[model samples]
Target: MEQAQMPGCYRHPGVETGVRCTRCERPICHACMVDAAVGFQCPECVRDGSGTGHSRTANQPRTIAGGRITAGHPHLVTQVLIGLNLLIFLLGRLNPALIDETVLIGFAFDPDLGRVVGVADGEWYRLVTSMFLHQEVWHIAGNMLLLWLLGGTLEEELGRVRYLTLYLLSGLAGSAFTYLIAAENQGSLGASGAIYGLLGATVVLVRRLNRDMRPIMALVVINLVITFAWDGIAWEAHIGGLIAGVILAYAMVNGPRERRALLQGAACALVLGLTLATVVLRTAALT
Candidate 1:
C-alpha cells in the first residue's frame, strides 16, 4: 500500500506541512506562514489583503484577539451557545432518563440499565454533555444568565471561534477536575466551570483594554466566595476552569506579534492535554 500524499507548502512545493492559510486555504510551512488579521496567511494571500475580507490591513474589521469582526451580530456565538444549553436542559426535563445517561460521573453503576456507566466506564462524552445539562430551573437560570451577560462580551472581543473555544475547553476542564476530586459514585453537573472561565477571561480583558477593574473585580470575588461557601458547589471545577481560562485568555489577548497563532495554539493544546491527562489518571485510579 502507498501512503497518502502529503500537502506541500504552496510557496515551497517540496516542503510538506498540514498548516493552511486561513484565507486562501493553501498549505503553508512554518517559514512561509504569516499571522494575518485573523490567522495564518500565505504570502500571496497577504499580498491580496486589500481585495479580500481578511488581512492585517485597515480595510478589514478585527477583534482585540484578531478574529474577523462580525459587526451585525457580535454576540452571535454567545446566543447560540446559550440557546443550545437551554435546549439541552429542556430536553433533559422532557426526558428525565437522558439526564442519568449524560450527567458527569467518575464511575457508577446504573441499576436501571443493569450496567456500569460513567467517564471511567469510557463514556467520556459526559464531560461535554453535562456542561450543557441542568436539572433544576434555578440551576439553568443562573448559568444561562451568567453566560448571556459574560459570553456576549467575550464573543465580541475574541470573535466567535476563540470565544467558543474558550467556553467548551473551560467546561471540559471543569468536568475533568471534578472527576478527579469528587467521589467515584458522585455525579456533578453545571456550566459553572465554563462560566467561571469567562469570568476570569473578563478580568484579563478588562485589564488589557485598560477598563475600570472595580466592578469586575468585585464580581469575581463574589463568585469565588460563593463557590466556597455554597453547599453542593463543585469548587474544584470552578478553580480548574478559572485557571485554564486565565492562561488561555492571556495567550489570546497578549500573544506576541509575528507568532500569535503559534503561541495561542500551543496554549489551547496545553489546556486540552492537561484535561485529558487528568481524566486518564482519574479513570485509572477508579478502575
Candidate 2:
C-alpha cells in the first residue's frame, strides 16, 4: 500500500500527518486532531482558529472584580443607546413641521414656560423625554461622537445595565437641575444634558481607574467655558446636567457595600425627587 500523503501540520511544520488541519489545511495525526465548527483540525490550528487556545478546559464562566459578566462586545449597550438617540434626532429633523412648538412643548424640557404663557402648556414629562431629543444635525453628531469615543470604555468597565443606568440617571439629574435653575417660563430642548452626564460619568471612571484625567478634565472645562461663552447655548442645562452626572457617578463608583445596586436605586430615587421639586418650583414661580 502507498503511504498516505503527508502535508505536515499547517501551523507547525516538520510534524508529518495523514489528515489535514481543518483551519490551515495541513495534514496531521490523530493526536493533533481537534473537533471544530467546520471539521476536524490539528490542535495547533484549532487553537488559532477557535481563538480559545489549545489547552482550553471546560467552558468556565469568568467573573470580573465586581462580579460583572464579560460578553463578546462589552460596549454594545452604549452603542445602542447612542444609535437610538441619533435615530430619534434624525427622524425629528425629517419634517421641520414635526419639530414644532407642540412637539417641543410636549417633549422638550421647559421650566413651565408654556404653562405660564397659558398657551398649550408644558408637561413635567418633558424633562426626562427631552434627553432623547436633539434639535440640529450638528448637535446630534457632536453628542453621538462623544458617546462613541467615551462611552465604550465606561460600558466595558461598568457593564451594560450599570452603564445605561448611569447615563439615564445622569440625564435626568441634568434636566432636573436645569428646570430648577432656569428662569420660570423658559423653554429648553436637546440631549446636551445627557451628553454632559456621560462626561460626568467619565470623570468618575477616570478617578476610580486611577488614570490621568487631566486631558478629560481639560476637555470638560473647555466645553463648559465654550458653552457659557457661546450664543444660543443653554448653559443652564449644561451646568445642571454636569452636576447631576458628577453626583450620579460618585454614587456609582463609591457607594456602600452593595454599591452597584444601591447606587442605581439611589439615582432613580434622587431623580424622582428632583423632578417633582423642580416641577413644583417652576409651577409656583410661573403661576
Candidate 3:
C-alpha cells in the first residue's frame, strides 16, 4: 500500500490532475483553476460536481490564520442575532400586553450622569440588552434586513467570533449614547443603531480594500437623510453606532496585509469598555 506519486505540480495522479482546486477537492490544470477567497478551486468540479470537496492550496491567498477562507457567508453569530430579534418581534405581536409592560423594561434608555459622577443609580446591562429590542414592525424589519445585507459579508471578512464582537459592541455603543443623551426619556428600542454600525464598518473595509465606495457612501447618506427626516428614527443611536463602527473598522481593518484581525480585536475591546461604563452609570443611577 504505497501512495501514488503526485506529478510535479499535480500532487495527485492517475487522472491527469494538473493543479488542485483550493475550494473543492478537484484536479484541475492551470487553465481550469478558479481563484477563491482563500485559495483556488477547480472550475470543472465547482461547476460540475455540485460544489463540494474543496481543499486549500498554498498558492491561494491566506488570512492571518494561514488558511483560505470564505467571505459573505452567514456566520452563526449573525444568524443567532437575527433569530433572536425576529423571535422577540413575533412574541411582542402575539402578546400586546407583554410588549407594553416590557417595552420600557427591556429596551428603554436610562441616563445617569449622576451615577457616572458617583451620585445616582444605573442599569449596565441595558447597554447590550437594548440592542435586542425593537419598537415597531417596520423598525425590526429595516434593521434585520440591513443586518442580513451587511452582517454576513462582515462576518465572512472578519471571521465569526470577531464579527460577533464588533456587532454587539456597536449595538451597545448606540444604546449607551441613547441613554446618555435621552436619559430623561422612558427608553428606546430598535436595530438601527447596530445597522448604522454595520454601515460604518462597511465604509472602512471598502476603503481599506481599495474598492470604490461611492455606492456605499451614497447609501449611507440616504439612510442618514431618512434618519433625520423621519421623526420616528433614533438618530442618536444611529450616530453612536456609526461612530463605534468607524472606530472598530479603523482598528480592525486598516492595514496593507493581515492587520484587520488585530484591529478588529482592539476595536471590540474598546467598544466593550466604553459601553459597559455607560451601562454601569445608568444602572447605578436607576437604583
Model 2 has how many clashing residue pairs?
Answer: 4
Model 3 stretches astray by more than 4 angstroms: 1-76, 97-122, 256-262, 281-287
Give all candidate RMSDs, comma-separated: 12.4, 12.8, 10.3
Better of 1 and 3 by TM-score: 1
lDDT tens digits, residue span 108-180, model 2: 3334333333112445566666777878778778888888887887776566666777677667666666666
Clashing pairs in 1: none
Query: Candidate 3, residues 1-287: lDDT per residue as tens digits?
Result: 99885543232122244466655565654333556555566534444443434433223433322223343444667888899999987887787544433332322332432222211223344455557777687888888888988987787655566576668777778877777666444456777788899899989877755567899999899999999999866677899999998898777655434464565566677887887686666655666
CA lDDT scores, all candidates in order: 0.83, 0.63, 0.64
Ten-residue stretch with the least lDDT total in model 3: 112-121
Candidate number with the higher TM-score (1 or 2): 1
Q: Which candidate is the best by lDDT?
A: 1
Which structure is stronger by lDDT: 1 or 2? 1
Report the number of the highest-TM-score candidate: 1
Write candidate 1's Cα lDDT for 1-287 as tens digits: 99888787764465578898777788886555666667677655665564256565523444557666564776888888888888998898899888899999888888876889999999999999888889889988988898998998888778799999999899889999999999998888889999989998999888876567899999999989989999988898899899889988988888565687888899899999999999999989988
